[model samples]
Target: MPDVAEVRRRTWVPGRPVDVLATLGPLRRGAHDPTWRVDPDGTLWRGVRTPEGPATLRLSSRPALGEVAASAWGPGATWLLDSLPALLGAGDDVSGFVPRHPRVVAAGRMFSGWRVPRTGLVVEALVPTVLEQKVTGQEAYSAWRRLVRRHGEPAPGAEGRLWVAPAAVTWGRIPSWAWLQAGVDGARSATVVRSVRAAGRLEECVDLDRVSARRRLRAVPGVGVWT
Candidate 1:
């Protein structure tokens, strides 16, 4: 609805084998996540709220051609397309990783194409992760699905009922009743609200060292070792 136009497209040929799904799979909150979908034809669809705006991104791997074709729609289409390589793990460095155990070696070989994706959206990653604290996967995922579906906007060009997660300000403004209705407890909801309120500082963690990032994250109330 935000002045969406004809789809913007890009083709990326990574120097290493990129397992798009495996790299991005960890981002999916659950099977019923409103922000993620996989089509029958093996296309991966994601609804994201980038710094520019909301966008719908589609990715399909062309094994024969050794390329991945990506397309996007909405105000943030260009931004999403521009970040595709990093989002698909182009920045991941595994040159020093050495698998010592037999199982580790086997898994490395099995998932050689898999790389850790760097989304660089700290608030987006943190909110749901906070919800998952001390709860079963089912409960956390259910609450996440409910909250996103209720507060999020429809993705511009998603084929089905996909949505982009609410912006940080919106997350902070979510009502207590609304959070309760979504099965999120007061403590968890409070953490989410607090995290979003300090989103600027949290986003800075992307540029900080590992120790500093962890220390900063621990400063937030209700966030701990497990979180």
Candidate 2:
């Protein structure tokens, strides 16, 4: 692991309030997910596999400073810093979304700081989503934890035992016996392998329109409306 002196750092001030928790919380697979963690002091840590390489990112919101402080380490440090704004919901456009219902209005007001984050890593998102198909939350999370901890790499600068998810090629290479041992069925495991094999096409969905992206994803054998 690199020392703090070798860390790359950045600060981002969004035009609107950003709820760092709400934005990134959905990405956590479970309380024990090896890819995500929350420190006692409320700092958020994430281990991710960027196109460049693996990285460990630490984020802290400084409301008084009206900015988010971020530090990253590993070969992917620069990529993580460059994508910080989008990962914090800077790309979310809610200007035209009108809430007419009373409950909707109240909910919006209550979660005003919340925005959808875009990590732009298709294989990272898809493998987990496939694992969750038609399974209980407990079952899905267990499978995810098992597979990642077993196959993934230890995050570069993580304070604890956080891990970076396996790359697309790694996901494709996981054997059937390993998948079954992780509690994943043949169908779901096949879907994951097939998706990772075509990871290049799937990743391009990030730049496509919603309709086109759905079409491209649905073209895969096991992917459907729910996936």
TM-score each candidate.
Answer: 0.95, 0.95
**Tens digit per residue, CA lDDT, model 2, 74-126:** 88888999999999988889989899999999999999989999998888888
Clashing pairs for model 1 are none
Residue 125 local lDDT, model 1: 91
lDDT of 2: 0.90
**Model 1: per-residue Cα lDDT over 59-113, one tens digit each:** 9998788899999999999999999999998888888999999999999999988
> In candidate 1, what residue range of length 10 has the lowest lDDT sum?
1-10
In Å, residue 11's CA in model 1 sits off its true spot by 0.4
The residue ranges of model 1 lying beyond 4 angstroms of the native Cα positions read none
- Estimate candidate 1's alpha-carbon lDDT, on a 0 to 1 scale: 0.91
lDDT against the true structure, per candidate, is 0.91, 0.90
- Candidate number achieving the greatest lDDT relative to the actual structure: 1
